[model samples]
Target chain A: MMNIPEDISPWLAIPVVLLLIGGSLITLIGTLGLLRLPHFYQRIHGPAISITFGAGSFLLASMLYFTVLQQRLVIHELLITAFVMLTAPVTAMLLMRTAVYRDLRNGRQSPDLKPPTPPASGHATTAGANSPGLMEETRDRNPE
Target chain B: MKLLVEIALYFSQFCIVLAMLLCMLRLLKGPTAQDRVLALDTLWICAMLFALLLGISFASLVYFEWAMLIALTGFVSSVALAKFLMRGEIIE
Candidate 1:
């Protein structure tokens, strides 16, 4: 087994401590947001905090600890980190879209009112009242 | 010094387990399918962290690898669930 020198102690310990505490706190915040946020779309922001910064910090701590202990570069942690960063936004986007679709299907308030009407159809048609076709259209336009 | 590390590892693991329990509460209490899916995602993250802590405590690389795979599969499943929620179908 390789040994890490004593000189590296201060450098390693501080960052590890920081990562551990910071990651835990962020995760707590995310959970709180999940619980406290009033609506599903609003609640979506909460886990983004965990998936991004919280996971990032944890991964940093792991990388530092293992690299120091093993006395070599440990890059496998990066694979997890990179996978998280790449997939988180995609998942969040999908969740958001799904929330919107569900709300629309149930005739709940539009979370955002900014999607201007299609140029050909100048007005935002209230799909709730008029057309079964509109429901099918929304589903088709944003297929799962 | 070994005892100190063990204590710290145990504490971290405990915190992660507590978080997972909170997530389970949300999963069970969720009023919407989307909310449950979010809780499931959160639970997966906690479990991955727990696995990492176990790996560190035991000085094992295999647990770390297992944690990585869990994260990957969790992401895929959450995305698929979200997609299903969106269009009421997962496949074309």
Candidate 2:
């Protein structure tokens, strides 16, 4: 194994350790919320929290640690950070839409839920009001 | 001192794997599509972190590239899944 010097200064280690610990704790909280939240819509919020901060912290830690060890700019971690920030919310939005479509199709009332208005002509029609499978199919076709 | 850092890295990896397992359980038990999607998203993030830890442990650049690729592909898949959920079609 090629030896990379273990020369990280205490100043750097402080933030690296803090980032790792904080990221882990946030992810744990998100998972707990996923398990404990009462409804799908509510539970979706849990992992969102994790991806935003949990992934962000770890990425930051990686950047800091590698930069110190290598004595140069370590920027690749940014790619992961950028990817997570952009994608997590989009995924959440799509899933929420799918869940809503399912609820509507089943006539399963979501308290405080407003009905979806009919789509304009050329927009895909909602499957028969009672068909969950068709609704799921529609969700699959339209990944926006 | 090197040994201590290795221990810390290993401990962090352990916690990450535990979180990944919990996320998997949610994925399997999810009552709604949204819950499953969320779990899957969490799983990808965990995987990326795991890859990074591996890179650190091995002191290799190769794992970092793999991690980036995982992050990229995971994003695309989740987006596709979400879009399908939204409009019932991925490409149309």
The prediction achieving the highest TM-score against the true structure is 1
Regions more than 4 Å wrong, model 2? A1-8, A111-144, B1-4
- lDDT for model 1 comes to 0.73
- The lDDT for every candidate, in the order shown, is 0.73, 0.73
B1-92, model 1: which lDDT tens digit per residue?
44344445566666677677777878887777888999898888877877776776666788888889899889989988988888778997
Q: Judged by DockQ, which candidate is best?
A: 2
In angstroms, the error of model 1 at A4 is: 13
Could you give the C-alpha RMSD of every candidate to the true structure, in order shown? Answer: 6.4, 6.4
Worst 10 residues of 2 chain A by lDDT: A121-130
Model 1's chain B yields a TM-score of 0.96
lDDT of 1 by residue, A42-138 (tens): 7778878877877788888888888887899997999998888898888888887887777666653353444434445634445442345664555
Residue A88, model 1: lDDT of: 82
What TM-score, to 2 decimals, does candidate 2 have? 0.78
For model 1, fnat equals 0.30
